[model samples]
Target: MTGSTLVGALVVGLAVGAVGRLVLPGRKAVPVWLTLALGVAAALLGAIVVGLVDRRPGGSPLLPLVVQTGFAAVAVVLAVVAAGRQTSPDPAARRKEEV
Candidate 1:
């Protein structure tokens, strides 16, 4: 990809990550690296979905922006699931029940 494309990806990733974090507002053991990784993942996933929906084989000039935004929203939902799962420990403790 070109420098511009790379930049676009980074921007999309960061935006997705930020939105995801906001949606998943809970205690997490997430570090900066994980957040960044998740963002990048979201961007790629979003782009793929957009490309599929728009019938863009690779990527178009205007598609990234729209795809990124949509992807960020999706990332938010995924983040909420991840964060909620992380924060809420197993309510049914097998050991406690056995005792």
Candidate 2:
């Protein structure tokens, strides 16, 4: 990919990530870098899906953006859940602390 294309993708990814974070309910502790990375991945995946589903030339651009944003939102939720799992204290530890 061209430098300009890469740059454009990064920008879009960042925007998508921010939107995804906003769409999620409740507070999330996801890092910015992780969100950006997930957004970029989601954007690429969304493009691939769109390409597979819609082979027609001159298709609407909005569909791809929507799909990417949706993917980003899902990614954010997954990231948060994964992070939670890693950071959650053990049940034994929790009980000890409570005691």
Which candidate tops TM-score?
A: 2
Full-model lDDT for every candidate:
0.65, 0.70
Query: Model 2 segments beyond 4 Å from truth?
Result: 1-9, 21-29, 87-92, 96-99
Kindly provide the TM-score of model 2 when superposed on the true structure, using C-alpha atoms: 0.68
Best by lDDT: 2
Looking at candidate 1, what is the lDDT of residue 21? Answer: 67
Candidate 1, superposed: residue stretches over 4 Å from native: 48-60, 86-99
lDDT of 1 by residue, 16-55 (tens): 6765666566665566456767777767766666556775
TM-score of structure candidate 1: 0.57
RMSD to the hidden true structure, all candidates: 5.0, 3.4
